[model samples]
Target: MERRTISVTGMSCNGCEQNVESALQNIEGVTRVEADRGGDTVEIVTEDDVADDDIEAAIENAGYDVAT
Candidate 1:
């Protein structure tokens, strides 16, 4: 699997972590997702190739902002 660490914003609590995780996990090609509100970061594990835009969109869709 391929791992990616992404920076994000607007996450203040654990619930926000779950939301971001759920959103990213729903994306195609993604196998695992871990989000941390403390550092505003997300770590994703994917089985297939995943686009950066797709990941960013998933985070945004979950009411968070991915750092550009």
Candidate 2:
């Protein structure tokens, strides 16, 4: 599994964190997703060939900003 931690912005509550988590989890290769609103970070585990752009786009679609 590939693991990465992405810094997220604009997450103010657990609901926002959930949104981020849900978005990331929807990706095909993604296996796990954990978003922390307090720390503004998201940890993701994927199978193979996970694109950073795809992950970032997912966050953006959920109304959050992701920093590389």
Candidate 3:
């Protein structure tokens, strides 16, 4: 598995974290997702073929912004 930690913004509470986690988990290659609202970050574990644009899009679609 490949792991990536992405800085994210607009997560303010536990529910926000859950939203981010759930969104990322829906990706086919993703095996794990951990969102920390306090740190404004989301850590994900996924298959090697997963694309970074897909991850950023998932976060954006979930109403958050992935730090550039």
Top-scoring candidate (TM-score): 3
- Candidate 2 lands at a TM-score of 0.94
Q: lDDT of each structure? A: 0.90, 0.91, 0.95
Q: Give lDDT for model 2.
A: 0.91
Give the per-residue lDDT of model 1 (tens digit) for 1-59. Answer: 89999999999998999999999889889988889888889999997678898999989
* Model 2: residues with Cα > 4 Å off, grouped in runs: none
Write the residue-wise lDDT of candidate 2 on 1-68 in tens digits: 89999999999988998899999999999999999988889999998798988999999999988776
TM-score of 3: 0.97
Report the candidate with higher lDDT, 2 versus 3. Answer: 3
Count of clashing residue pairs in every prediction: 0, 0, 0
- How far residue 3's Cα lies from its native spot in candidate 1, in Å, is 0.6
Q: Total clashes, candidate 1?
A: 0
Q: lDDT of model 3 at residue 34?
A: 95
TM-score of each: 0.92, 0.94, 0.97
Question: Which is better, 1 or 2, measured by lDDT?
Answer: 2
Where does the lowest 10-residue lDDT sum fall in candidate 1? 46-55
